[model samples]
Structure formats: C-alpha cells, structure tokens
Target: MSTDSPTDGAGAAASVQRLFRNTVVAVSGALSRRDGRVSLSVSGLAYFLLYLAGLRHLGFGPSGYEVSVVSNPLVRAFRQVGPFQWEPIALVVVGPVELLVAPLNMLLGAVLAALVGLNLAVSIVAWRGPSACRLGPGAGAMSGLPGLLSGFACCGPTILLVVGIQASAGLLSLFQWLLPLTVVALLGTLLWVGSRVETAQQVA
Candidate 1:
C-alpha cells in the first residue's frame, strides 16, 4: 500500500483546483474577444475535419447519395480495434464524398479538436496581447504537435505509404501511444499556457 497522507491529498487537490481556475480564466479571457472566438471556431472545425480525414472516414468516391447503418449500431460503436479507435457502424455517401460514421471515434476526435482549438486560441491571443502576455511561437508549435502526431496514429498502416518508412513491431507499438500522448500533451500545454496567462495578468 502507498503511504500518501491526507495533507498530501489535500495539497494535490488544491493544486488541481488552482490549475483549473487559472485555465478557466485564460479560456474565458481569450473567448471574450472576436479574434479568439474566430480562432476557436475556424481552428476547431479545420482540426475536426483533418482528424476525420486522418481516420479515413471522410474522402472522395463516386458521385452518389447513400446512408448505410450497420445492425446494432449502439453495440458496435463501443467496439475497439486500436488504441483510441472504435469501429464504424455506418456509411454516409453524398456526391463524391463518403464518411464512416463511428460514434466513439467522432467523440474522441471532437475532444481532441476542441483541445487543439482552445490551445491555439489561448496561445495566439496571449501572444498577440500585451508584452507581458506574449507566449511566442513555442505555444503554436506545442499546439500543433498533437494534431500531427494523432493524425499519424489515425492513419495506421497507411501512414507508412506517406512517410515511405518500413513498418515494424516497434513502430506499430509506438503508434498505440501516439493518441494518448497527444491528449496528454494537449492538456499539459493548455495548462502551461494558462499558467503563463495567469502570471501575465498578475504581473500587469
């Protein structure tokens, strides 16, 4: 058994509370302006579409309109075939585009997209604001890394075709963690950016 005491637990809880409060402050502050709102909407939508494209759920095909749903979609939606990936239970085709409707995957992608958007918006707003609040290019890079890494993960074996790299067990194993790592990085960077924003507010 672990030896952590009540005081340690309380301290950790307080720390988490502070972090969340600061993050909320940062987010609310960013979204209060037109630029931040635009950033969130555009970036979020773009990232979500890119994420679906990475999953190969949205793509071009013969021109037609059709919607197909699998039997027992509710049950199938929970089925997992890869790390952070779920089975698609429907097919939607309209014109030259097609989409595999996977409820779980869509949910996950939405979450990742939202995080990426918020990260970019907060970082961009902070960087463009007063001198004390400038977060710089590092924030942009951090915000982008998750989308790229997770996109590669979503591509699965197909990514090898794009990168021209031979597949191996080691490489495949690494892919399993990419989405999770991306999530962690997104959250961590969000908190870090918020902390900077909070500090800047304090300084000013």
Candidate 2:
C-alpha cells in the first residue's frame, strides 16, 4: 500500500496556479500591446469627423449628376459579342472644379479609415514578438503615413476651393484615383507584414 505525501500534493497545486498566472499575464500583455494602434485609429476617425463638419459648415455638398446605360455597337464589336445592355454606371457630372471638393473629401476619409484598420492589424502581429512574427519594430506605425497624406489631399483641395481657386480636370482626376490607390497600397503593406509574421512564426 502507498500513501501520497501532503507536501507533494501542495507543490503540484502551486505549480498549476503559477502556470495559470503566467498564461494570464502573457495574454494581457499581448492585448495591451495593441493600445497604440487603437489610439491612432481613434484619432484618425476623429479627424475625419472634424473634416466633414468643416465641409458642411463651409457650404460644400454633393453636386447634381445623372447617369444612363445603353447598349453601344462599338463596345459590342470590340468584345465580339452580341448586343448587351451595359451595366448602369453612375457618372458624376463634371461641373465647377469646386463641386468636386465634397467627393474628394469623402474619398480621402474612406482612405484614412482603411489605413487605420490595416495599421491596427499589422500592429497586433508586430506586438506579438519576433518569435510570433517578424516585423521590424514600428512597421505598423510607419504604414499609416500614406493614409495621412491622402487625408491632407482633401484638406488642401478644400482650402483651394474655398479660396475660389479652380482645379483643372486633370488634377481632379488625379484626386479621384488617389484614394483608391492609397487604400490598395495600405492593404498590400498589411498583407506583406502579415505574411512575414506568419512565415517567421512557422519557421520558429
């Protein structure tokens, strides 16, 4: 017959408790590392709100436009396909350059939001430590600069519009595409960073 020692049982219980405590600490630390990303995203959102408010206060709003869809012979011939009705495409009527201000501002705001989301995701991976994933320190923070610059595009154009300066069609087109490009770039950066982290984690 065998009897368990009281001291051995107590030591086993203490070991389990210690392991639980360490796990909790590690989880909390990992979560806390995301604080910076959260703060930046909130700040970016606030800036968007302020910008929209300013635009409304300054008498800027959506311009009137109409779009129609019709089957075109040229399009059909180019595709070597039978007559087909094209999809309804809404085209903003090109009016006074100032009229483009509101749309441009909206685009920039969207870009900023996208950037913030990507930055937060990247930051989380980065904070997980090199063992979890390998992103150089601060990579997530630096990724936000393009989004910030895109936001500035809206401010600068709005200022020019308010000052009665007209922007050329070419310039307006550039602004039109800038937001989408910025969003894509931010997404690409996020993917790149995430892949690096994933790869490192796998290797480790």
**lDDT digits (tens) for residues 1-204 of candidate 2:** 989999999999986665444333322333355554464566457556544443432233356453333356334323311111122222334432122123444555656654554444334534545333333455434534543444454455444545566789676456545545555655555444443332233446
lDDT of each: 0.70, 0.45
Candidate RMSDs in order: 4.7, 16.0
Per-model TM-score on C-alpha atoms: 0.75, 0.39
Worst 10 residues of 1 by lDDT: 130-139
In the range 1-204, model 1's lDDT, one tens digit per residue, is 879999999999998887777677777877876778898888778778777776678788999999999999999999998777899999999999999999888998899778877777776666566222343434544534543444334444434534457678676667656777777877887677655443445556
Q: Which residue window of length 10 is worst by lDDT in model 2?
A: 80-89
Model 2 steric clash total: 0
